[model samples]
Target chain A: MKTDRTPKIGFGIRKIILALVIPFIIVLIWLYATMYTSIPHGILPTIPEVGQTFVEMLKSGQMKEDILISISRVLKGYLISAVLGIFFGSLIGMYQPVKELLVPIITVIRQIPMIAWIPLIVLWCGIGETSKVVIIVLVAFFQILVNTQSGIESTPKGYIEVAKLYKLSRWKTFTKVYLPHAVPQILVGLRLGLGGSWMAVVAAELIAATSGIGYRMSSARSNMQSDVVIVCMIVVGIVGVLMDKGIGVIFAALTPWRKVENENRKEE
Target chain B: MKEAKDEIRENDNSYIINVEHLNKQFIVDKQPMEVLHDINLKIKKGEFITIVGHSGCGKSTLLKIMCGLVDYEDGIVERNGHAVVGPGPKCGMVFQDHRLLPWLKIKDNVGFGLKNLPKQEREEKVRKHLEMVGLKGFENSYPSQLSGGMSQRAAIARGLANNPTILLLDEPFGALDALTRIQMQKEILRIQEEEKTTMVMVTHDIDEAIYLGDRIVVMSARPGEIKEIIEVDKAESRKRSGAGFAAYKKRIYDYFFEDSDVEYDVEYVI
Candidate 1:
């Protein structure tokens, strides 16, 4: 079985480079077109202008303040939703009565997008931090809830039977068997929730925020400073990727067994 | 012959598990479907009993019922004279798929049932059982890192680590390749002899039933019932190809296919 399929270090590096090649080409095209074309700077800023604005924002400390505020809001909202979602999701998944009573209501509520509730939420919470956080929570809650419930539900019956045979206590079974089985799915939900939180926070900021990456973009748009808008967009995209990669690292740590399977698939 | 076996069981106080008039039914498509009927079995202490039958014969259900993983509407299942109400530590079960937790290391998987024990004692038992199952060095490995046979071995170790009075196996080797299945058969036999643990296993393989079981319980399908119980009446080192073994296989085959029109293809080039 130990054949030529073992991936070489150089090969892996080449694959990484190959993945970046297309993005590199796209950026190159954007730079060439903006620099060479007759398009106005107000409509489409050059790459150097966006880069200059990014550095200036970083040095001025205004960008840092906005990023910190947005991150704190996202964290507050995401953490609340994650805790509540997993807690209630596990209960609904494990108990039939809870599921029957709440699933229909949850399904109906999930159908209403987070943005749709912004008006009502702002009216209730008065366009404050509370309203923004609530919006982010609504966005993050459904994905985590659904994924956590499905993860718990889809735990292999065989493992449950083994737990039964050993006469494991309910708590023991949940922690040792069900929780471990659901980790991968739960992580997936968290990643998705994180993404939703970013989107929701940005939308909330665009509508009413005093300071955030989204608010910065909104102000720049009205002021026709496209360089600042582009800079904010780049920051948002990079931050989202970084957050996702952070979750990926945690997931790999929790599920080392899956890493081996993934490597085998790569070999195949 | 059945009466004689019952008499022997009545005379001895060594029976660890007893089932009488066990009946089970399932609701399928809003219709009641009987799965097991009038199933009677007695497994003595330290005895190895293998129940063999066709698919849908309710043999696996029977094992589940014994392990208290399934409930039967009517029947008396007694473990050491006490009625089985639910799953308890007295019975450990091994499933067809080596259901070792993928997130747990082999040692942790084996020690799963020993949660009530002290950490040191549980670790000792886990190590001993892992060594017995020929998985000494693979303790730290995850189930995904192990091969199918190795994972199954870890599962058996987990079953045995609990030190249950009886171990119930549901087609434990059914998923293995032929050679690994044979090896696992020998491994189980050795474990059974060493531990002297009572074992009741369900299998579809007739040869495996004869090879490992002290008494082979043949079940019939379509509302499964015990058709016959044949005592191997041979030493532990009995030969598979010997005439005595062939005679037992013939008897079981006759009990299963005697009334059916199934033709046997005995001629082979090799």
Candidate 2:
């Protein structure tokens, strides 16, 4: 309507092509390597074979079940950690006594790798999904807590001064000023926590689990079903990308002012 | 025009802010270092005063004291005949840094200090000040999206949105480019004329002091004290580059730059 002179990059065709580039390159290299190589048959499982395996797996709903299990655990563990971490983080952020007492404990726990807790967790909780959830929560909670505290601490002092001068109630100041200021940082923390929990869940499942993508991969490895394992890995990659992009979209929706700023920069 | 405003205010002996024998000393590693010494100054009903000094001078600290943002070692600051304890909405301030909440839109930032007010009223007040600062259409834009001059204007709009009786500006336009700085000075002067709020600005620019200040108060470097207060009778005409403007500029320059031995038409009040 306004002459539409600005050259906008099309997300439709361009995005599809961009998304396919890595897979295309991988398939091309696989085809070329298999075509001229002296590799034994059925051992390498050429690109076409893997594609066939992927279609068969999709049709049989093996991929779907594994994905659902993984997602459910990630969602449960990540959500719980997000709630608890923000509550405790804010408490520590606002009070010096709480911060001094808890910070050292948090730091020590955070230093211990997520995998380091896997054996103990499995032994304590048994192979029931409890251990996997515990691992995910452990990995995610630290990220959420650290980031939330950092976000609260980094809020500008001038804004707080303005709040005090305006005679805003303590609750109002936290909700209106402090909360909005910390949104972007806290969102980043959530993103990191969710992604970290995803990795931890998969690892925990790999070690001890009855069902999940990680369990499927372990079984496929034992049966020498490399194509199935590769398919599971692809599913993991795709799901991770989707989750990250979904969070990014949510960020844009919540903070439209950022979009305006980006458009301004492009004009400049 | 200025004389008429002063004359009208002369009949009402109501002093909005009274500062008496204010002294400030910063304890730097257990050493009592004095910055402001026996600084006794009074701002009447609707006066526009500007303080100009060098970097080390305590102009900023004095401004903090005036806004009750920082405490002084010894002072009696009374607002409306009541002793000042801490920052109140009666005094509004704008720092050199725009200090707009990065996450907030322009309209919301202007309403930041009006958090206690009703939502509809706050929104209306924010709109009025946005229009006053010529940012009518940029209500939804963030501080990051604004130019340096525009952000500073938004900062001024935020300060004035509170509608305080006394406005404290601490070198608000010092961060802008030369051209933008000049434009902002003119904009602020026009706003002050319209608002008629008692204003105290701290600046290091002598030319800026001459351009915007109705009266310039110069402070000495260490243990900052008011060295001279020069009244610019023809400030409107002095803003332009003419002989009268040059004479007034020379008077302030002499007060700050000239040796004590130099003879000038400066009346030392303290």
Candidate 3:
């Protein structure tokens, strides 16, 4: 058995090495261009210079504070949108009257982009944390609502018959049948919403924030500190990837049935 | 009709289910189409009845109406002297697709119908039924993890877990392969004998109808109506290859081909 598994393990490792090769090559080219060539200092900083700036930001605790503020904003906005989206989406999905009443209005509002709302939100709530958070909320809310509605509407007819035959109550049907069926789609919406929240936070901070990664990048741009800007960009990309992976883990944990379903399909 | 009434009245306690003057219609493309016309059926306690017809014969719809999952225009369906207004705990149904919730484990799926019971009692009943279906060790497995046959078994377990008086099955083995279908037939027979639950099943397979049902209800398409009801006397020891079984098969075959618009050419090549 041990000998039989060796080729599979070797194949996985080889694939990982292949995936990393392109990024490694690009980094090498970047290092050569910045260190050896005369590309001017302000245009593009060397990798080590950016790395040094990152270390200094960490030591001074400024990066930590900005990151915390941005993350807290995302959390608050995302939580509110997720709760309301699921609640109202389910109502609209299950009831035709509710859908007819609210869908058109929500669709009209959703057509207006999150960035467009920044001006009005800033005017209403001022250039404070409320405006930035509201912008993020608007960015995240629509995706969750649409996904949740579709997910609920697309529940299998067979499952609905089961619910009817068992005479499940309305609440029980929602909790047991509809909720579990919609979970994967809801998670998809959540992942998309998180990415949107990150982008919106940066935009909001750039427009009207006292302190955040977006503010730091904008300030660095004004001061001609390209290294600081690069450092902030790297930090944001890393955090975004980590958050996505974290949600992926939760998705796998919640939907254990999907694993067996994919395996059955493969066998077929 | 008078004979049926007398029979029902004579053994009021013996009949577990009684259906009379059942008429069902559906609106298709703004046209009113009658599916079942003035149908009547009487099922005794612990009886196994199979309704066999071709596709679009409305046999499934009839079963659904009996299970209270569909509404009928004119009918009186009674179970143990009480009218069946809607679905309740007394009747359990196993669907054609083995509609087990994909998110739930096998144990929870089986125990789903028994949610009104106490926690300990529900778990015990689920365990017993799961063991009955030969799925003792698969309690934690999801429906997707099981084979088609295994999933059908789980569905049967779920239907019986409530210990209902009557179990309605709508082509439960229709999707299974031939071998698995035969095995499921025998498994259902064994379960019916052990539990003594009345079963009303719909199937398009004649052999399945003859092999399992105490009475085979043969129906015709185009506003589906019962053509005949054949009684199987030797339900205890049925032999598919026996001469009696051949006779029954020929009788059912004639009903479909004798007066129907369908034509057959004996010498036609494949």
Candidate 4:
């Protein structure tokens, strides 16, 4: 299984050159769209105009506040979601009775998309920081929970039997056998949940928030300042990419054994 | 069944493991299917016992039952005169796949069952067992870092680490190549000789049974039962290419294939 393959990290110069090709093509299209087309600047800002506005936002400290505010909100909600998801997921995964009792309702709730939860959450928590964080929790929790549950559930029967043969206590077995087996999968969940948090936070801010990057985009949209809107979008994309890479780096360090494979002794 | 119990009673407490009329059933498609029926075995302390049977003969099941890894009803299976309800520390088992936890290093996997000991004592025991299995330099290596034979050696080390009175090996070298398997067989024999621990190995390989076992229990499939028990003279059976080894192989082969149309009389006799 490719399961044991060490995730390749650290882009080479050649790799960086290859990766930048698509973005460069996209920028060429953007420059053409603004300079050559009759489309108004209000609708699609010129690349230079967007870059100038980006510098203005940075100088004003507006860019820093917006990015930091959104990041902090995502972190707060993400941590709470991670804890709740893993705790409940492990219980449901380990026990048949708990899984039977909880899974059906959770499946139904997860069907309702994150955006659909915002109006109701805004009504209940009232467009404050609580509403945004709650919306994020609602969005990210299920993603983390389902992934964690599957990871724990799919632990090899042989491994569990080994633990049982050792007569390890239930808690000890979970920690040593189930938990370690599930770590890589659990990391996948945490990454997805982090991604989900950004979506939830942005959507919540666009619909109701008074501050944050999403709010800045919407306010710029209404004022016909397309350059500011484009700048916010670029900043959001960059932050999301950075956070994703950060999670990869952290989890890689945490699970060193996963990255070490013996070429001569691949498991049968 | 009554005779079986009487036989056990006649035998002294030198027997570390005793099974009288042991029967095990598993439910398949909601039907009660017997895996082991009327199994009677008595193993003395420090004796190396090998159970030989075909695949699907429930030999592995019997080994698991002995080690308290599997439950059985309507059986008198005892380890050290105590009925085995569940797995205990004294009964260590090695499985065919070398079931080492992939996440743990060889040292951690070997020391897994050595609970409630001082740090130094546990480390010492792990080091000793790893050294015993000829895996001295691989303490820091993960299970995947080792080849199949090496992994099985680590598994054997793990089994011995707990200092169990009984070690049950269920086809422990089944996954290794022929040369590696032969090497492993020699290593296990040496380990058993040095430790003097009661070793019970289950295998489908006839030669392995003759080579290592002090007594080889030949079992038949479809509700597995002991067909015959052959005593091996260590001096004679240790010579794998000698006439005595082939003679034992011939006898075990008859127990497995005699009922079938394949003729073995000409091929076996010199």
Cα-based lDDT for every prediction: 0.87, 0.83, 0.88, 0.90
**Chain B TM-score of model 3, please?**
0.91
lDDT of 1 by residue, A62-154 (tens): 899888889899999999999988988888878899999999999999999788899899889976789888998898988998899999999
The candidate that wins on lDDT is 4
Q: Which stretches of candidate 2 lie over 4 Å from their true place?
A: A1-43, A92-96, B1-13, B235-239, B259-270
Quick one: best TM-score, which candidate? 4
Docking class of 4: medium
Comparing 2 and 4 by TM-score, which wins? Answer: 4
| Standalone chain B TM-score for every prediction | 0.93, 0.89, 0.91, 0.93
Positional deviation of residue A31's Cα in model 3 after best superposition, in angstroms: 3.8
Which order, best to worst by TM-score? 4, 3, 1, 2
**After superposition, candidate 4 runs with Cα above 4 Å error:** A1-14, A262-268, B1-10, B259-270
Consecutive 10-residue window with the lowest summed lDDT within model 3 chain B: B261-270
lDDT for each residue of candidate 3 in A18-54, tens digit (9 for 90 to 100): 9999989989999999979999768798888888999
Best-first order by DockQ = 3, 1, 4, 2
lDDT for position B236 in model 2:
53
**Predicted model with the maximum DockQ:** 3
**Candidate 3 on B217-244: residue-level lDDT in tens?**
9999878899898887664327877778
By summed lDDT, the worst window of 10 consecutive residues in model 1 chain A runs over A1-10
lDDT by residue for model 1 (B121-169), tens:
9999999999999999998888888888999899999998978889999
